[model samples]
Target chain A: MAREPGGEKIVNPNPMMSNGNNCQRLFRLLLGLLLAVLAAGLGYVLSSLPSPAPGLSKPVAEHLEASGVSNPVTAVLLNYRAYDTLLELGVLLLAPLGVWSLGVAARHREPLVDPVLDMLARLLVPMLILVAGYLLWAGAHAPGGAFQAGSVLAAAGVLLLLSGWWPGPAFSGLPLRVSLTAGPGVFLVAGVALMFAGGRMLEYPPPFAGALILLIEAAATWSIGITLAALFAGGRPVAGPHR
Target chain B: MSLLQPVFDIVLGLALLWLAWRAVASPDLFRGIVLFIAFGLVMALVWVRLDAPDIALAEAAIGGGLTGALLLATLARLESGGGAGTGRGKDRESEPNDE
Candidate 1:
């Protein structure tokens, strides 16, 4: 850095650094151009393809009655492609477990004792819980489901934690573990049960599909709620001193 | 009224693009996160316009709300850890206290 005659500070660029910067700029420009061309080519090819006469939605709707759910989306999720739903639940459970594997954080029990937050939690948590339950129940007919309900439930838990009413380790225990795995466990059991009952794996008998889906959803909601809450907690909870 | 719908769509689309660009380009991490949360919110509106209320709800709740909260908390933790110990910046002392 040096002051020029005009009293302006100037820093000389190193030759090697300038060369590296130029290389990066060239690479970025080439990458952008290649991606743009690829995108345009793909778009052209896709647009040229003829549209299907009968879309998949029609068939999905036709078979929806047999899936035991009124909502076509729910029918598709809980019945038509239950394997995917099972895997998604497994992934949700994996998140908390993965966090736990990182080892516990130093336990500093600092309860945020703000009056406003406490009051807000008191007013909102119970109402949010009700909304979550409603969303779960409405999934059979409406645009809500285990995932949405579970997210709301997790939000309530987070609210409580923020207000300092709920301890960090409140969710840590054998019972919590069981609840965390309940969704995928129940889903697996249902699959195995169907296999034993003369149906293919995950192929719920038509008469019983509705009940099975509801049961699986209930379990999944619980597990998802716990999993999301644990993820926000950011570390494994050890057994509390009280425990 | 039909013209209004198209106008709204154009405006929303432009807003979404602008918010996304700013979110990705912001130099400050905190500002970037706040912009990202706003982008999620606008994206939820896009989902609503596309007639996917379920996705809109999920995006707003999870993407905008919970994810924003988690990111903010993580930022606070990081700042508190690095700021308090290293005394890197003059603003370090006041940062954790704000939380």
Candidate 2:
């Protein structure tokens, strides 16, 4: 709150400077207090909860047979509620574009972290990728599916971003473009193909419902992974400065 | 209060709020950007607890991930040729020149 000048220090020492500092400190303090209150409320909800849902889908159960995808949540996400997933992809598309527009771009060197953290990221990456694939495949019977699987993959992308591997903004290229469009593109084409062949849009024509759902989900899974990784890169036009 | 849900919820919530508060309070604009990314992830978890998987996925993938990237990129632009923070200061300095 004190300032020194060549000769002006004795006069006022810029009372405005002290006032600005006080305002900033007060702002931070109030912000912390607000956060504390929010945290307390959140703590109450998280630590106190009801039992988990039975992992069943009421809509799927009521109208149709299992379709052999025993995990009703998977069925709901991939089949019954497939449209929601499509729109989700749309939001994914908008985020990066917004970066290029609303955000300024940068061309920075990447950040450096503790070697131990780097090692952990390295170790976690491949394992998470494998787990994601397995989860995607097993969604037919387990409490996992495209969404969960995609998240795990996204987690890996995040790890890559944090670890200075994939970098950011400069992520634009063939692969990124491909991954971004692949999910909904495949579904739209497949649905059209089925429609042209006399089936309904996204209608698998009987027993293949599960298979079609799987394919759509697989595409979605890959798209989600890429989108997340790139999105984690945010709007920076390039990599980041080493911190 | 049931079982593990509450525990996860509290962790998720506090983690998010901390990030938000820090992002607001951080003196170095760059630090605030990073903290905001963390805040996004924690909020994604909150969406999950609310049983909105769709929202959670979007939050995690787009909200948390891309927004951080954008902020970092902006900081990069602010830094550009010289060095990041210095470049930003230079840009600030050049403001009067443009006028």
C-alpha lDDT values of all predictions? 0.79, 0.68
Model 2 scores a C-alpha lDDT of 0.68
Candidate 2 error regions (>4 Å): A1-58, A64-68, A100-107, A167-172, A235-243, B1-99
Return the top candidate by DockQ: 1
Please write out the lDDT profile of model 1 over residues A1-243, one tens digit for every residue: 122222222233566877776776697789989999999999999998887745679899898889988988788889999999999998888888776776553322467878888889999999999998998889999988888888898899778767775444565688789989999999999999999999999998889999999999999988888778777766666687522
The positional error of residue A118 in candidate 1, measured at the CA in angstroms, is 0.5
Q: Write the per-residue lDDT of candidate 2 for residues A85-119, one digit (tens) a residue.
A: 67777786776666545443332555676798899
Candidate 1 docks with a DockQ of 0.25
| Index of the highest-TM-score prediction | 1
**Scoring only chain A, what TM-score does candidate 1 earn?**
0.86
Mind sharing the TM-score for model 2?
0.58
DockQ of structure 2: 0.16
